[model samples]
Every structure is written in structure tokens, then in C-alpha cells.
Target: MTSMTMLEAINATLRDEMARDDRVLLLGQDVAQLGGVFRATEGLLERFGPDRVVDMPLAEAVIVGAAIGLAAAGLVPVAEMQFLGFSHQAFHQIGAQLARMRYRSQGRFPMPVVLRAPFGGGVRTPELHSEALEAQFVQSPGLQVVMPATAADAKGLLQTAIRQPDPVLFCEPLRGYRLVRDEVPDGDAPVPFGTARVAREGDDVTIIAWSAAVHVARRAADRLAEENISAAVLDLRTLVPLDEAGILDAVAATGRAVVVHEAPFTGGFGAEVVATISDGAFYSLEAPVARVCPPDTPYPAGKIEDYYLPSVERVVAAARATVKAP
Candidate 1:
């Protein structure tokens, strides 16, 4: 195992995947010369050459549309969107063409493309650079949505996504890129989708989160432990092929749940988790599922983002509320 940050793990994974599979190529704005905005693709161009790591125009639609063509022609293109908030510009290409290619082609065409973007808040990025719009992508059929919170999962999940048959939207947490660190396995081992990892084991309440919120939930669990409140933190690594069984099992054991996410309270991915628990483990629940999310407002400035994003205190409060809900 090697101690590395999320970005380092991602860079290593991309390097490994490209080297292992000649068909794997990368493309996006400033990816080649600039090495990506976050340097996630740093040193890739020098290693893979310009043909394998092509830099495209400043257009998300063009980037995704071209990737669709590349994937159809036999190349596994890993396209970067710079930021999740800016992805709306290419929604038509992603949702209409890339996502529907496999289903629309009736088993003829397979789009094994990876659309990656930096997401979430805490770094105080400008508008369209820090939005947690994961719920939007999760709704896209045939599009696998992956958000890795830790360094190890970042590399493992990305490798798995690249090797998969369908298109994947890999949401790399901006704050976690350098802040989060873990002992990643020496060799490439794919972390499967639809499997949730239990970050912390407890029987009092289940805390569900993904991306950067996982760390916040972990901190909340640590604080709750001091109060003798045992909280089990569940990280739903992939949102599309969600680990329903794992989510249900954790909530069933605890009899209560508190979902924390950085997105708005309304129409957030947390609601889907809560709904699933409500349908699958309704009888086992001791209290109503609680969600700790930001208000239905735009991503705030970095100065006051603390008030808009989920924090340890907010999660603890939500957990306390869930326990109190008779």
C-alpha cells in the first residue's frame, strides 16, 4: 500500500490504465499542455504523447460529443469536464447522445466512455465550479455515476469505470483531491460499483453520504461516539447503481438514519437513499429518516459556505433529531 492523496491516486490510476490498455485515451480542455486544471492528468501528455492525450477546444458539448464518437469507433475516451457545474452546457450531448447510445443502438453500439469532473464545495470556487449536482447525473439512464471520497476508492473506482462497458460520470471531489489521503493498494484493483462501504460500524444510527460529505459524516460519527451514540457511516460510492442491500442492512441494524450531502435539501440524492430505506426497511426504522443538507439556494461564496454546506455539527444535530424522533 502507498500513502497518497486523492489526486495522486487518480493520476496514477489514469497512467496505469492507459499503459495497460492502449485503447484508453484522455481528452479535455487544457488536459494535454496544462495537465488539467487540478493537475490530475499531470505528466500524462509527456508519457502518452499528444495523440493519446489530446487537448480540445473550450467546449463541454464538443468534448463529450467527440468522446461519444471515439467510444463508438473503439477507443475508451476519458473526457474531463473541468467542473460539474459547467456540465450543464453539455447536458444534451451527455444525456441525449452519450447516455442513450447503447440503448438507442439496440445492442449494436457500446459507449465505454468516462466523463470526469471536479465537484462539491469547501474550496470556495467560483460559480459553476463547486456545485454538487450529482442528483442530476444519477437520473441519466445508462450513465453510471461514481463519486469517490477517499484516495484508494478514487483510483480503484476510476479503473473500474474505465474498464466497464457503459459510460461513467466520475465525480472527483475538489476539496478531497488533495485533502483526503489513504493507503492505496500497490497494484490496480477495481472497486466494483453498486457496493457501499461501511466507513464506521455502529448500531445507533446509519449515516449515509458520498464524496466530500463522507468525511463530514465520519467526523460527526466520531463526535457522536463521545456522547455514547454509536453511529454507522455508510459511503454510497456510486449513486446510479446504488448499493440498496448495504443501505438497507445498515439502516435496519440501527433502526434510524441520517443522510448528509452537500446539495440542496430538495431533489438531492439523499432523498433517494431515504426513499429506498423507507420502502425497504420501513418496519425496521425506529425514527423517521433525517437529512442534513443545504438550503434550496445557489452555491454560496467561500466565506459563508460553511452556513450552506453540511458540517459535522449539522450531521450530529440531524442524528440527534433522528434519535429523538419517536
Candidate 2:
């Protein structure tokens, strides 16, 4: 096993995947010369040449459209959107053509395309660079949404996303790119989708989260442990193919749940989790399923980001409320 950050693991995975399969190519703005904004694709151009490691124009739509064409033909293309907020510019191509290609083709095209983007607050990005709009992509049918919180999960999940037959929207947390670290296994085996890992084992309450929120949930669980409140952290690695059974099982054991996410509270992915718990483990719940998320307002600036985004304090408070609720 090699100890690495999420960004290093991603870069290694991309390099390995490209070397393992010649058809796997990469395309995005500044990917070739600049080696990507975050340098995730650094040194790839020199190794694979410009043909495989391409540098596209500053157009998210064209990047995705070209990837769709490549997938339809034969090659597996992993396209990057620089920042997730820029994906809105290519929503039509992604939702209309790329996602529905396999179903629309009637067993012809597998749509083996992976659309990657970096998002989530922290590190203080400018406008349109830090929005956690994962729920929006989850609503778009025919797309497998994946958000990896740790360095190991990031490597395994991205490997899985590239090898899979369906189109995947892989969301990487901006903060976690360099901040989160883990000992990643050497093998390139794909981590199965729709399977949630237990970040921490506890019987008092279940804290469900993905991507960056997983760390927050872990910190909150640690804080709750100080008060003798055991909180289990369930990391839902992938959102689209959600692990309903795992979620229900965790909540059933704990009898309480607190869902955490960075998106707004009104319609974030947390709502769907709460709904799942309500429908499957309603009787098992000792108190209402609580949620800790951002407000309905837009992504706050960096100055007030600590106050706006879901913090460990907020998650701890929500868990305490649920555990103490009558």
C-alpha cells in the first residue's frame, strides 16, 4: 500500500488506467500543456503524447460532446470539467446525449464515459467554482453519480467509473484533493458501486454522508463520542446507485440517523436519504431523521464559508438533538 493524497491517487490512477488500456484517453482545458488546473493530469502528456492526453478549448459543451462521440465510436473517454460549476454549460450534452446514449441505442453503445469535476467548499474558490450541486446531477436519469471522500475511495471509485459500461459523473471534493490522505492498495481492482462503507462503527446513531461531508461526519462522530454518544459514519460513496439496504441496516441498528451534506438543505441529496430511511426504517427510528446542510442561499464567499457550509459543530448538534429527542 502507498500513502497518498486524493489528488496523487487520482493522478496515479489515471496514469495506470491509460497504460493498462490504450483506448482510455483524457481531454480537458489545459490538460496537456498546463497539466490541468489542479495538476491531476500532470506529466501525462509527455508519457502518453498529445493524441491520448489532449488539450481542448475552453468549452465544457465541446469537451463533453467530443467525449460522447468518442464513446459512441469505441474509445473510453474520461472528460474533466475543471470545476463542477462549469458543468452547467454542458448540461444538455451530458443529460441528453451522453447519458441516454446506451438506452437510446438499444444495446449498441455502452456509453462508457466518465465526466469528472472538482467541487465542494473550502480552499476559497471564486464564483462558479465551489458549488456542490450533486443533487442536480442525481435528478438526471441515466447517470451514475459518484463522490469519493477519501484518497483510497477516490482511487478505487475512479477506477470503477472508468471501467464500467455506464456513464458516470464523478464528483471530487476540491478541499479533499490535497487535504485527505490514505493508504491506497496497489491493485487496480474496481470498487463495486452502490456499496457504502462504514467509516466508524457506533450503535447510538447513523451519520450518512459522501465526498467532503464524510470527513465532517467523522469529526462530529468523534466529538459525540466524547459525550458517550456513539455515532456510526456511513459513507455512501455513490449516490445514483445508492445502497438502500446498507442505509436501512445502519439506521435499524442505531435507531437514529443524521444525514450530512454540503448542498442546500431544501433539496440536497440528504433529502433522498432521509426519505429512504423514512420508507424503509421508519419504525426503527427513535427520533426524526435530522439533516445538517447549507442554507437555501447560493454558495457563500470564502470569508463566510466556515459559517455557511455544514461544520462539525452543526453535525454534532444535530446528532445530539436526535439522540436526546423524546
Candidate 3:
């Protein structure tokens, strides 16, 4: 057991993976010399050398396109996009080429590439630095989108993403990089994908969320407990290969649910959660599925970010409304 921040856990995981596998390498703008914008790749360059920790130009398209070639050639390339909003520049390569490589090659090619990016509001970053555009990646057929809410999950999920045969979009919560910390296990055993963790147990309502929103849901659950409204918090760690069973189980146990995320309400991943519950757990539902999210507007600047991001107050209110619905 080790007490470490999410940033430390990610840096350690990258180091461990690179040391364990010779073919594992990193490429991103300022990842080598500048040690990444978040310092997630701090000591990797010194330890792995320039060949393995190659610094890339400021072109997301060229970076992702080159990674596809590297993966097809046998090396496991972990490309960092600095910010999830910037991933749009490589949408063609990511959604078109890298995602369909295995299918296009008829299983002849393995797209073992990991695209890492830090996202979500509350970090007060510049424009295009804190957008929660995960729903876009979830629509990509061959891509897997993962968002870790804690230090331990961050390490475990990164290990799993690096070793996966298909392409993975690893979304790290910028707010949690330093705010969240926990005891991470001391092994290389990768946490499997498509699994959800129950952050809290209850019977009145289920609060489902991913990434930084998990923290808000947990806090909301705690507040609801004071009012004798038992609320369960479900952390959907990975979105692409969503944990259907886990989500259904949680919703069935509570009979009510509120989906939360930092993204916009319309076309957000929360809608998928609501739709899944409607399809599979509809009979068990006591109330309509509620969603706690921001409006479908552009991510606002830092000054008014609090008004744009989902808060614990909003989550608590939604949970209360779901429980009171009859």
C-alpha cells in the first residue's frame, strides 16, 4: 500500500510499464524535455532515454497518425494529447484509421495504442484544455474510453490501457490529479476494463458518475445520508466498455438513479446511462432517471466555470428529487 496523489500514481505507472516492457514508448509535445504539461512523464525521459521518450511536434494529427504506424509495426506507443479538447485535431486518425485498423486488416494488425489526455473543469486551464468530450470517443467503435477518479484506479487503469490490444482513450480528471489520493496496490496486475466500482452502498437512490464527478456523487451521498435518504454512489470507471451488469445491479438495488458528469446534458454520457437503465432495469425503477449536468453550451471560461460544472449541491438535489419522485 502506498499513499500517493493521482499524478504520482500515473507517473509511477508509466515508469513501471516502460521498465517492464521494452517495446513500450511515449511520444507527445513537451513530454520528454518538459516532462509533460502535467508532469505525468517527469522522469521517464531520463530513465528511458530519448529513443523511447521521443518528443513530438505540436500536431495532434501527425502524432496520432504516427502512433498508428508505430503500433502496426509492433511497438506499443502511448501518445499524449495534452488536453482532450485538442484530440479533435486527430479525430480522423483516431476515429477512422487507428480505430478500424484491426477490422480493416481482418485481425492481422493489432492497434495497441494508448492515447492519454487530462480533461474536466475545475483546473482553471485555458480554452480547449478542460473540455469533457468523452461522449464523442465513446461513439467510436473500436476505441475504449476510460476515466479514473482516484489515485489507485488511475494506476490500475493505465496499466490495463497500456497492455490492451485495442486502442484506448485514457481520460484523466484534471481536478483529481492533485486533489484525490489513495493507497494503490503494489503489483503489476492490471485492473480489467468494463468494471464499475461501488463508492458507497445504499437503497434509496443510485448516483452514477465517472471521472471527477464521482467525487461529487460521493459527497452528495454523504449529505443525503444526513437526511436519512440512503443513496448509493456508482463509479463507472470506463465508459466505452461500460459495465452493464454493475450499472443494472446498482440501479436495481436502489430503484432510483441520478446520472452525473462534468459534460453537457444533451448528448452527454449520462444520457447513455439513463437509456441503459431504461432498457435493462426499467421494471425495477421506481422513478424516472435524473441527470445532473451542465447545459449544452461551450465550456465557459474559468471565471464562471463553477456555474458550468456539476457540483455536489446539484447532485444532492437530483438524488433527492429522484428519491422523492412518485
Candidate 4:
């Protein structure tokens, strides 16, 4: 096991997958020579050469459109959008073309492409740099979405998504890229989608989250423990193929749930989770599932962004509400 940052782990996975499969190729802006703005693609250009690790022009639409053509021609292309907010430029290509290729062609062609984007706020990036747009992809059909909270899951899920025979929207929390470190096992370790990990077990309330919110839930769970409130933390690793069984099970055990995320509360991924629990575990639930999410507004400037983002106190308050509610 080696301790590595989430970015390093992702880079290692890309390198290993490229080495294992000749068809796997990476393309994006500043991916080759510049090693990406976050250095996630560092050392890849030298290791795999320019052909496999490519640096394309500064057009997300063209990059995604070209990736669609590449995938249609029988190559597993892992395309990167510099930031999640920029993916809007390729929505038509991704949502209309790449995602619908298999169904449109009746399985004659499969777009085995993984669209990777560094997402979420916390680093206080400029206007559009720190957006959490998972709900955009989640609402769209024909695309699988996965977000990893730890370095291990980041590496494992990226490898699995690269190998899957469909289009995958892999959202990596930018805040977790360098903030969290974990010892990842060597060799090919692919964590299957639709699985959730229990970060912490508790009986008071279940805290459901993904990506960076998983860390928030964990911290809140720890804080709750001090108050004699046991909060379970469930990391919804993959959002689209959400672990419905795990989520329902946790809520059944705890009898209460608090869904949390950095995304805005309105129409965010948390709504889907709350709906799912309401549908599947309504009878088992002791209290209405509450969501602890960002306010429904544009990410504030750095000065007040901290207030906009959900904090441990917010999560703890939600947990208390869930427990004390009639």
C-alpha cells in the first residue's frame, strides 16, 4: 500500500489502464505537456508519449466531439473537461450524441468513453471553476455518473469506468484532489459501480453523501459522537447507479437520514436520495429525511463562500432535527 493524493491515484490509474489496453487514450486541454492545470495528468505525457496522452486545442466542444468520433472508431477515449463548469460547452455532443450512441445505433456501436471533470467548491476558484454539476449529468439518461471521496475510490472507479462499455461522467471532487490521502493497494483495483461504502457505522441517524461531502459527513459524525449521538456515514460512490440497497439498509437501521452535499439544495442530487428513501424506506423511517445542502444560489465569492457551503454544524443540526422530529 502506498499513500498518495487523489490526483496521483487517478494518474496512476490512467497510466496503468493505458499500459494494459492499447485502445485506452486520454485527450484534453493541457493534458500532455502542461500535465493538466491540477497536475493530475503529470508524468503521463512522458510515460505514454503524446499519442496516448494528448494535448488538444482550447475548445471543449471540439474535444468532446473528437472523442465521440474516436470512440465510434473503436478506441476507449478518456476525455477530460478542465472543470465541471466548462462541460456545458459539450452538452450537445455528450448528452445528444455520445450518451445515446449505443441506443441510437442499436448496439452496433458503443461509446466506451469516460468524461472526467474536476468538480466542487472549497478551493475558492473563480466564477465557474468550482461548480458541482453532477445533477446535470444525473438528470440526463444514457450516462453513468460516479464520484469518489477517497484516493482509493478515485483510482479504482476511474479504472472501472474506463473499462465499462458505455459513456461515463466521472466527477472528481477538486477539493479532495490534494486534501485527503489514503494508502491504495497496488495493481489493478477496480471498485464496481452501484456500491456504497459505510465510512462510519452508527444508530442515531444516517448521513448520506458523495465526493467531498463524504468528508463533511464523516466529520459531522465524529462531532455527533461527542454528544452521544451516533451518526452513520454512507458514501454514495456512484450517483447514477446509486446503491439503493445500501442506502435503504442504513436508513432502516438508523430510522433517520440526513442527505448532504455541496451542491445547491434545489434540484440537487440530494433530492433524488431523499425521494428514493421516501419511496423505498418510508415505512422504516422514523423521521422525514432532511437535506443539508448549499443554498439555491450561485456560489458566492470567496469572502462569503464559506457560509454558502454546508458545514459540520449544519450537518449536526440536521441530524439533531432528524432525531428529535416527531
Candidate 5:
């Protein structure tokens, strides 16, 4: 086991994939020369050379459009959008063209591409740099959205995304890049999609979260334990092909559920989870499903973001409500 940060784990995965497959290429602004604004792609340019790790202009649309062309021609291209909010520029290319290529082409064209973007607002980044617009992608069909919580999962999921035949939207939690460190397994280990990991086991309430919210949920669970409330924390690593069975089973065992995320509460990804649980696990539910997420507003400026983002206290309050509500 090796102790590594989330950024280091991602860098390791890209290095390994590029070394194993010559077809794997990376394209994004400042990806090759500057190693990305967050430096997640650091040292990759040196290792893979300029040809495979080519830097492009500051145009998300052009970057994703070019990636589709490369993928259609049998090259695995990983396109980074710098930040999640900026992905809107490439929505047409990703949602319309790349997503439907395989079906429209009758399986003649396969888009083995990965669209990576840093998301969430705990890092106090500038406007349009820390938005969690996961619902936008979740609403679009034929696209897989993944958000890994830990360093180990980051490496594993990134590898899986690169190797997948379809387009994958890899949402990396900006807060977890350097804040969290853990012991990652040695050698190549790719975490399969549609799998949920139990971050902590409990019998009281099931807390479902992904990306940066997972850490918040875990912290809330820990604090709740002191008050005699044991919360089961479930990390939904992949959002698109959700691990319904895992979520249902956990909620059934706990008899209560609370879905959490950094996105706005109105039309957020947590709403989808709550709906799914209501449909599949209604009979077993002892309390109404609750959600702990940001308010329905644009991600606030650095000064008031702390109030906008869900904190451990807020999550604990939601969980407590589930247990105490009549």
C-alpha cells in the first residue's frame, strides 16, 4: 500500500494507461505544458511527450469536438474541461454528437473518450470553476457520470473510464485533490462502474453521497456516533449506472435514508436517488427520504460559499430529522 493524494493517484493512472496503450492521448488547455491549473496532469507531458499529451486552446467545445473525431478514428482521447462549469461550452458536442455516434452509426463508430472536469466548491475557487452540475449529465442519456471520493477510487475509476468504449464524464472533487490522502493498493486496480462502497457500517440511517459530499457524510456520521446515532455511509462512486441494489439494500437495512451532494437541492442528483429509493424501497422505509444539499442558487462567491455548501452539521441535522420525524 502507498499513501497518495487524489491528484497523485490520477496522475499515476494516466501515466500507467499511456504507457500501456499508445492510442491513449490527452488534450486540454494547459494540460501538456502547464500540467493543468490544478497540476493533476503534472509530469505527464514529460513522460508521454508532446504528441500524446497535446495542449489545446481555451475552447471546451473545440476540445471535446476534436476528441470525438479522435475517438471515432480509434484513438482513446481524455479531454479535460478545466472546471465543471466550463463543460457547458461542449454540451452540444458531448450530448448530441459523441453520445449518439455509436447508435447513429449502428455500432460502426465507438467513442472511447473520457471527459474529465474538476467540480465542487470547498476550495474557494473563482466563479464558474467549482459548480457541481451533475444533474445536467445525468439527464442526458448514453453518457456515464462517475464521481470518486477517495484517492484509491480516483485512480481505479479513471482507468476504467479511459478503457470504456462509451463516453464517460469523470467528475473529480476539487476539494479531495490535495486535502485527502489514503493508502492506495499497489499495482493496477480499476474499480468497476455501478458499484457502491460502504464507507461506514451502521444500523440507524443510511447516508448516500458521492464525490466531495462523501467525506462530509463520513464526518457527519462520525460526529453522530457520539450522540448514539450510527449512520451507514454509502459512497455511490458511479452516478449514471447507479448501484440501485446496493442503495436499496442499505436503506432497507437502516430503515431511513438521506441523500447528499454539493449540487443545488432543486433538481439535484440527490433527488434522483430519493426517487429511486421511494420506488424500490418504499415498503421498507421507516421515515421519509431526506436530502442534504446546497440551496437552489448559483454557486456563491468565495465569501458566502461556506453558507451555500452543505456542512457536517447540516448533514447531521438531516440524519437526525430522519430518525426523529413522526
Candidate 6:
């Protein structure tokens, strides 16, 4: 076991993958000389050389479009959007081209590309740097969206994303890059998708979340435990291949649930969780499914980000309400 921060784990994973596979390469603005805006690619440039760690111009569409071309040719290209919000510029390539390549070719082409972007509020970044857009990206039929909440998951999930045949939108929480740390396993075994990790066990309500919201939910569960309100925390690590069975199981065990995420409440991924529970575990539900998220609005500026992101207090309140509902 190794203790490392989420950012360190991601850096190590990239280094390990690049070393393990000759075809694995990286490209993005500042990914070479600058070693990535957050240094997630630090030391990789010297180790892998410019041919693999090439830096491109500041064009999101061009970067993703190029990645599709690279993947179709045979090399595995990991494209990075400086901030996830900037991916709005590459929706054409991401949604239309890369996502549909395999289907468009009738399985003739393999879109083995990994798009990495960091998001979530905190650290006071500028506009478009902290928008939690996992819900929006997962709408593409063939694309997979993964968000890791811990250091260990960061290493394992990224390995899976890199090695997988389809395109994966790897959303790393900026708040957790340096803040979250844990014991990561020693091997290269990738963590499979469509599975949820049980962060805590309880029989009252299951608090479902992903990315930074998982931490928020876990903290809320701890608070609820003090008051004798047992709450289970389920981290839905991947949103695209959502763990429907895991969710149904958690809800059946607890008979109540509160979905949480950094995205807004209106159409956030939390709504999908509630619907999944309502659809699959309806008979077991003891109360109306609840959602804990920010209001339906654009991500706010840095000054008021705390008010915008879902807080542990809000999660606890929602869990308490779900538990008390008759």
C-alpha cells in the first residue's frame, strides 16, 4: 500500500501507463513544457519524450478532434482540457465524432481515447474552471463519465479509462487533487466501471454521490450517526455506466435515499439516482427520494462558491428529512 494525494496518484498513474504501453501518449495545452496546469503530467515529458507528450495550441475542439484521429490510427491518446468548463468548446468533436466513431463505423473503429478534466468548486478558480458538468457529458450514448473521490480510486479508475476501448470522460475534482489522500494498491489492476463503493454501512438512508460530493455525503453520514440516524454512503464512481444494481441494493437495504452532487438540482445526475431507485427499488422505499445539490443555476464565481457547492450541512439536513419522512 502507498499513501499519496489524489493529484500524486494521477501523476503516478499516467507515468505508469505511459511506461507500460508504448502507444499511450498525452497531448494538451501546456502538457509538455509546463507539465500541465496542475502538474499532473510533471516529469512525464522528460520520461516519455516530446513525440508522446506533445503540447498543442489552446483549442479544445482541435485537441479532441486530434485525439479521435490518433485513436483511429492505433495509438491511445489522452486529451486534457485545461478546465472541464472549457470542454464546452469541444462538444462537436466529443459528442458527434469521438463518441460515435465505433457505431458510425459499425465496430470498425475503436475510440480508445481518454479525456481528462478537473472540475468542482473551491480553490477560488476563475469562471469556467470549476463547473461540475458530468451530468451534461454523460448524455452522449457511447461516452463513459468517471469521477474519482479518493486517491486510490483516482489511480485505479484512470487506469481503467486509459485501457478501455471506448471513450471516457475522466472528471477529477479540483478540490480533491491535493486535498484527498489514501492507501492505493500496488498493482496495475484497473477498477471496473458500473460499480459503486460502499463508503459506510447503515440501515436508515443511503446517501448517493460522486466525485467531491462523495466526501460531502460521507461527512454527512458521520454526523447523522452521532444522532442515531443510521445513513449509508454510496459513492457512485462512474455516472455513464451507472451502478443500477448497487443503487437498488443500497436503497433496498436502507429503504430511503438522498442523492447528492455538485451540479444543480433540476437535471443533475442526482435526479437519475432518484429515478433509478424509484424505478428499481420502489417497493422498498419508505419515504420519497430526496436530492441534495446546489440550486438550478450556472456555477457561481469564486467569492460565493461555498454557497454554491453542496455542503455537508445541506447533505445532513436532507438525510435527516428523508429519515424523518412518514
lDDT, candidate 2, 103-135, per-residue tens? 898879888999989999988888889999899
Assess candidate 2 and give its lDDT.
Answer: 0.94
lDDT of 1 by residue, 1-326 (tens): 99999999999999999999999999999899999989999999999999999999999999999999999899999999999999999999999889999999997889999999999999978777889989998888999999898999999999899999999999999999999999999896899999999999998999999999999999999999998899999999999899999999999999999999999999999899999998999999999999999999999988999999998999999898887788
**Which residue pairs come into collision in candidate 4?**
none
Full-model lDDT, candidate 5: 0.92
Q: TM-score for candidate 3, please give it.
A: 0.99
User: Root-mean-square deviation of each candidate, in angstroms?
Assistant: 0.7, 0.7, 0.7, 0.8, 0.8, 0.7
- What TM-score do all the candidates reach, one by one? 0.99, 0.99, 0.99, 0.98, 0.99, 0.99
Check candidate 3 and list the clashing pairs: none
Better of 3 and 4 by lDDT: 3
Kindly provide the TM-score of model 1 when superposed on the true structure, using C-alpha atoms.
Answer: 0.99
Residue 36's lDDT in candidate 2: 92
Which runs of model 4 end up more than 4 angstroms from their true locations?
none
Tell me the lDDT of candidate 1. Answer: 0.94
Off by over 4 Å in 6: none
Give the true-structure RMSD of model 2: 0.7
